[model samples]
Target chain A: MLRELFNSENSVLYHVGKFVMWQKEIYKKPENWSMYYKEIVRQMYDIGIGSLTIVMIISLFIGAVTAVQFSYQLSGGLIPEYYIGYVVRDMTIIELAATITCLVLAGKVGSNMAAEIGGMRQKEHIDAMEVMGVNTSAYIIMPKIIAAIIVIPLLVSLSAIVGIMGGYLASIATGSVTEADYIKGLRSFFVPYNVLMMYVKAFVFAFILTSVSCYQGYFVKGGSIELGEASTRAVVYSDILILVADFIIALVLTS
Target chain B: MIRVEKIHKSFGEQEVLKGIDFTFETGKTNLIIGKSGAGKTVLLKLLVGLMKPTKGKVWYDKLDFVNLSKEELQSLRMDVGMLFQGNALFDSLTVEENIRFPLDMFSKKMSIDEKQERVNTCLAKVELEGVNHKYPSEISGGMQKRVGIARAIVLNPKYLFCDEPNSGLDPKTAITIDELISNITKEFNITTVINTHDMNSVMEIGENICLLHQGKLAWQGSKEAVLDSSNETLTDFIFASPFLKKLRNAAAG
Candidate 1:
């Protein structure tokens, strides 16, 4: 039994168990509120403001391409061309905005969180903090998780707006629909429930990405090679989990 | 005082530290000296409660360290400070901020001015006063180590731990760092435990030395006892180099 326990120490079950246990440490009350506040503010800037440009670029194209594709599909069919605006608006708000934007952010913010914390682990900064009686888990990770949870939903909201605007611009430029008709299409089927769905997906994905990435980085061992592997795994795992969560949320919510 | 009894550590199938008993003296530089893989680092980690031993009782005065509650461990941790091998100063924070970090986090009663004054005092104690605003990356390795030392002592910890404190420094700088740590231990009357293989440190500030060989305590004594001791493991480790062996032989002659 002892030998078996020792052999299983490096298994996936072991890491998963360890990860679950670490959450307790992460959620403990802050030793000092102001210190936590400062860290949270710094992380908010890094995640929210620092990511604005990429999110904008990706969201714009997603919106444009979506508009043009629907416009082409609706042309000469039983459906009216103005349906493109309705389709783009709903698609951007419901699925594309949160899902695609989070996938992009899972790569951007997730890898960054992993690298930053993994670098600290490698350099023994975490150890230094542990020695200083600082709860390394709460101090290092809580801020990042809180910042991501708060700001990622906001970013998703921004992406939805920007994507809708991009659809409007593309349709007008290509003469796919008249401006008045497109505006009418946008107004025709506005479901308030879909906005709620978008936020649910956003908040859930934000937690998964940030928490998984920080976990990958926090427990990293060895040197640069291990740190790099941890970072890559953070992105990959976050993406997969985000997709999985998206499917589950869609199933439960849409039903 | 810090004491360990019957300490045993194992990683997977490999046992690194066998049952051993030792006490670290307060107000002195107590060195855990051994060749690589002899479990000096493991022992240090066990003492600091970073990694628990497979079997052991570690004591800080009368309190049982290994079996403390979370609150007790945290409270114990506040009295402990460690200087890591890489110096581990936050790259983004200036030296002042680095030293002031623990004070800011733990000493909530201290005002900003009081914290700044403490930082300044620590820097001055380490004889590094002028570069408070410089980030850690902008400083030299030695200066970073000094900043690390200042930060470690900023909270006036009852115990100080140094892991390979002289690993990256030039010989002169290594001696300077060693002397600084020794002086701090004496001045603060802190229980200072140092894990190193540096002969210079083992000779200069080694008031008490514990040598581990093949996961057991091979010897324990003062710096003065090191040269006269006839233990084969001690001699082999201390005089592994030909030049050092010849010097020992000449000294014996």
Candidate 2:
């Protein structure tokens, strides 16, 4: 039992050390700034415009549900009806928009990254680049991380606005609250720091998802079955890391 | 010239290459021929610095490749080109884009027109002139291999490594590829190393051949000596098939 425990611990440490070393290689000075810029532009288009619709859909529903549920809980209570909008606003901004939307993207974008890079590895494309003196890690992965960090936060901000709109639409449509009351709730007691917190969370989660997915894909070996497993692992690991980062960011930034 | 000294490689407990020492002469087609699991690919990878040897030193013309710093290695790699067995063409890029990738990444001083001219020259050298805009999937496998060769030589590298350059092609195309590599080797006088198990390649363009058997250098000789030599291991590998053995016997008679 002790030996098994030691072996497992060693495995974990080995992977952690490898992961850190991989990050160091990825951030090395690029060979050509223009080439990296072009890749970053392509990645921005892929991560940003490609992911807009899904983010809109999820954020809207999450806000609507929050509003409706808050309304139900406050029914016949002395608490004001407009509090539903406040609850939706704070929940969407402080947590849901950045965290949940990124969790979904961890499935969509993260898995795509893993499969693409892992396929490159399997096909020897990475080897070809390595031979040509291209820094495969920096060339392939850095742009992806940069693009994600730039775009995912923009996506989260958009989600926050759409979510608020969703909550407003839900409350006014259901006749549970007046428009003036909902607007008042949105305006009342707004903390700008919460928006800062949202952006911080978005950035951290974006880094986690992109870096973890790229790491998984960059080092992948074997054939198709292994590629598929890497894709799945990218999503699973990115989601787990995003949640963990979410908690830590909440503790650090919010405090 | 590229040389490996006392090269050894291992994966955990299993040793893949056990003390390989050889020199690949400049302006010659050097072949590393081996059966499956004979560490041909591992040695190729080590020479290219894609994988480090468990124990050995690789010298690229007096520079210790095994001990170069990361920046130094990258600089050294700029002068090296390689063709993978699968061709390794970027699937999404067009033929022109694929061929021009090395230039775009490394040749910062060259203008777009100069780069285009260079790409054209490489394509023409490979006999692939009119297929620039087509994707890899649209091209035939032979054309793709030619494109891969075109891409590898675009920068006029000092060293060229080809891993099974003729694996998936017809015999005629395989010979064409061998001749192309040979012509390029002589034309530019680049040190060329090919890792292949194809017996035909050994007889056709192998100026210097090193046969690996089960992790050791089994035989070293020229193509002229291959047919006449009585090395048991070489004979066994070359005549592994009964039909080839019969053909060899008939040819000998």
Candidate 3:
């Protein structure tokens, strides 16, 4: 009984420690850049292409809803009506569109990658690769990480455009702001820095999303039960880490 | 040549292998057989450097396998081939890709044509010539096992380790796998180490049988000698389980 308890305890510690080892392994070989790039392309298709429609639809609605809310309040003279255009563009594109879109992606792409790779690990394909002289790091993890990086940036850009368009439609319908003024408001703050910050956040989020999900999947144990557990843990952990990473990046960019 | 010297391995306090000492030679099938939980599997893992021994050293010729550097281990791994019990073929790769996988990773000198030729040759060796494009899922369990064997030997490894090569196969297919392994061992002159609980395998390809019992080497001899050995523990072990006893009885009859 004591021995079984110790074995389980040891196994838990080993898995946690193995996860950290996998994280460190990412930087162990810089020569794997090209392989990683190819992997990213594959992942990009899954993350971006698969989830494009939903992200776009959600972005548009968020933009329209925000514009409608702002138009109602701004017409009463508590705030200038021109500010409605700014609120729609800035809040939708800069904050809500970029960050929240990624949060949604964390559930979709992150969980999918986790479940797929977790299933592979549980089935022992990963060990089979190692036996055949194939590098597991290059053969498995590199592709997923690369795909996420390529896909997330494109998804972010798509969400930003759709969100602004949604705001334009809502503003036009409500008669709170003219189309020219809405276009002007978007062009006015076209701060290269703001655009650059969005790109930075997308890239960082992609890296975290892929890495954490892959890590959770790669180390999953037992049978179907552990796989289900891994999938859940991957989504939850990646979601939390994405928020934390976004906050850190936001602090860095703003300061 | 593979040399295991006084190897001790334990999973917690269970002590799966206690002082295992054996040498597997080239061009012969070395079989490790025992009842379940007799440490045959653990010993196989140790031989292949998958699981490290607690109190001994395994020398692949001169290099201490346990203490080798990562790069060294990777290099050594190139010389080794392993067939898992479940025929652990990668579901993502087709049989052709799986066979060519090691060649792509370890050999950059070969042209694509050369690689393809080698894959065909290996596929042919396992009698799986035209089924190259099939995925593990698309193939039968026996075919998957053959593909697993094809993949293992694709690199033309110096040492071949099989963990229950016939675990789930029918008796006919299982015997065929044993014969195939034996033929390959002779043809390539590779040091082939097999871990099995099958008495059929023990009688057929077991050029040297190491019977392990409760984490100890209960007996070690050839198939001919195994029949006449006076060790009571070995007899009880061989005839202990009903399945093996039935096999032995049928063979005698």
lDDT of 2 by residue, A1-255 (tens): 655544463465566667887888899999899999999999999999999999999999998888888999999999998888888999999999999999999999999999999999999999999999888999999999999999999999999999999999989889899999999999888999999999999999999999999888988889999899999989998998899888898889867
Kindly list the per-residue Cα lDDT of model 3 for residues A138-250, writing each as its tens digit: 56787777777777788888888888889899899878789888877776645678778888888888888778888878777888888888888888888888889888988
Model 2 residue A175 lDDT score: 87
lDDT of 1 by residue, A81-182 (tens): 778889999999999999998999989999999999999999989988887888999999999999999999999999999998899999999999989888
List the per-model TM-score of the A chain.
0.96, 0.96, 0.86
Judging by DockQ, tell me the better candidate of 2 and 3: 2
Error of 3 at A129 (Å): 2.1
Order of candidate numbers by DockQ, starting with the best: 2, 1, 3
Instruction: Give residue A232's lDDT in candidate 1 (0 to 100).
Output: 97
Which DockQ-derived CAPRI band holds candidate 2? high
Q: List the residue pairs that clash in candidate 3.
A: A39-A143, A40-A146, A40-A147, A43-A147, A44-A147
The runs of at least 3 residues in candidate 1 whose Cα sits more than 4 Å from the true structure, single-residue gaps closed, are A1-13
Q: Give candidate 1's error at residue A110 in angstroms.
A: 0.2
True contacts kept of each: 0.86, 0.95, 0.49
The weakest ten consecutive residues by lDDT in model 3 chain A span A27-36
Question: How well is each residue in B1-253 modelled by candidate 2, as lDDT tens digits?
Answer: 9999999999979999999999999999999998999999999999998899999899999999999997788788888989999999999899999999999999999999999999999999998889999999999989999999999999999999999999989999999999999999999999999999888899999899999999999999999999888999999998898999999889979
